[model samples]
Target: MSGVVVDVRGLAPVQRFINRLANPDLRALADSLGAELESQTRRRIAEEKTAPDGSPWAPWSAVHAATRHAGHSLLQGDGDLLDSVTYQVSGTQIRWGSPLVYAGVMREGASQGQFGTTRRGGPIPWGDIPGREFLGLSAENEDDLVGITEDWLQELMP
Candidate 1:
């Protein structure tokens, strides 16, 4: 109710596959990969300054949400490697192709007055990636975060 709305129909196959995977090895592999991706993304986010008020930039929940969303989006894409593999991230909101996109959206939303001041003077710029108006997060940078999620797609797909 307080966050952006995303269409999940775009990721149905992924949701279904994850639901069906009973292999612990595969599950663990997926988890490990997801954690690595999350860690890298968080590091990049942390490199950015917090709001002018010195508060934390973006919430951890939001970052987690964005990562999960990115995984789901990748699952939904057309790639042979990801077709049968189950990859999921816990606790997320949006479902998109990449974390960069979610970060961009969060950055834009915060900039557009969506979060609206949790501390003192109102919401502040908390994300490192500039908004689309400022060139946004580039594909190269996004790849750096997740290492060509498209490649994961190929690996996951048949």
Candidate 2:
């Protein structure tokens, strides 16, 4: 018997892996990713109070805070937004977010008069609101996804 120097589709399983990568099923992958995103988003809003980039969210203006009920926290008016955090797995995609109308405003912020004047013709928001980002993957999240993907790929291979 002679020692073989070459291998086909069996050298570390790279070929078989690559062949499957072309159009691999995304359901499992999407589910894992979406779940993590949902958890992180809710944590960002309810616990960390920081953006995915690790920056602290802008503090509420004194006037605005005064308007809120006693002991209310940022972005937790009725706990609806945080409770609404959810994820969905679509074909080759994982999208997660809140369906509430103000979700975008909270994520991206708004400037005075951005949404047009109020009924009395004053600025709608009255004051500028800085973005309080609560969605996105942090460095830790990216790393976790990499590990998850590796495990998923291994599971996919025979």
Best by the TM-score measure? 2
Off by over 4 Å in 1: 1-24, 48-105, 110-158
Best by lDDT: 2
Q: TM-score per candidate, in order?
A: 0.26, 0.78
Query: Can you write out model 2's per-residue Cα lDDT over 1-158, one digit (the tens) per residue?
Result: 88877756466577667767876878878899888889878888888998889999888999898899865788888899999999998876888999999899999999998999977899978999888989888999789888888998888785
Clashing pairs in 2: none
Residue-pair clashes per candidate, as listed? 11, 0
> Which stretches in model 2 have alpha-carbon errors above 4 Å?
1-24
Full-model lDDT, candidate 2? 0.87
lDDT of 1: 0.41
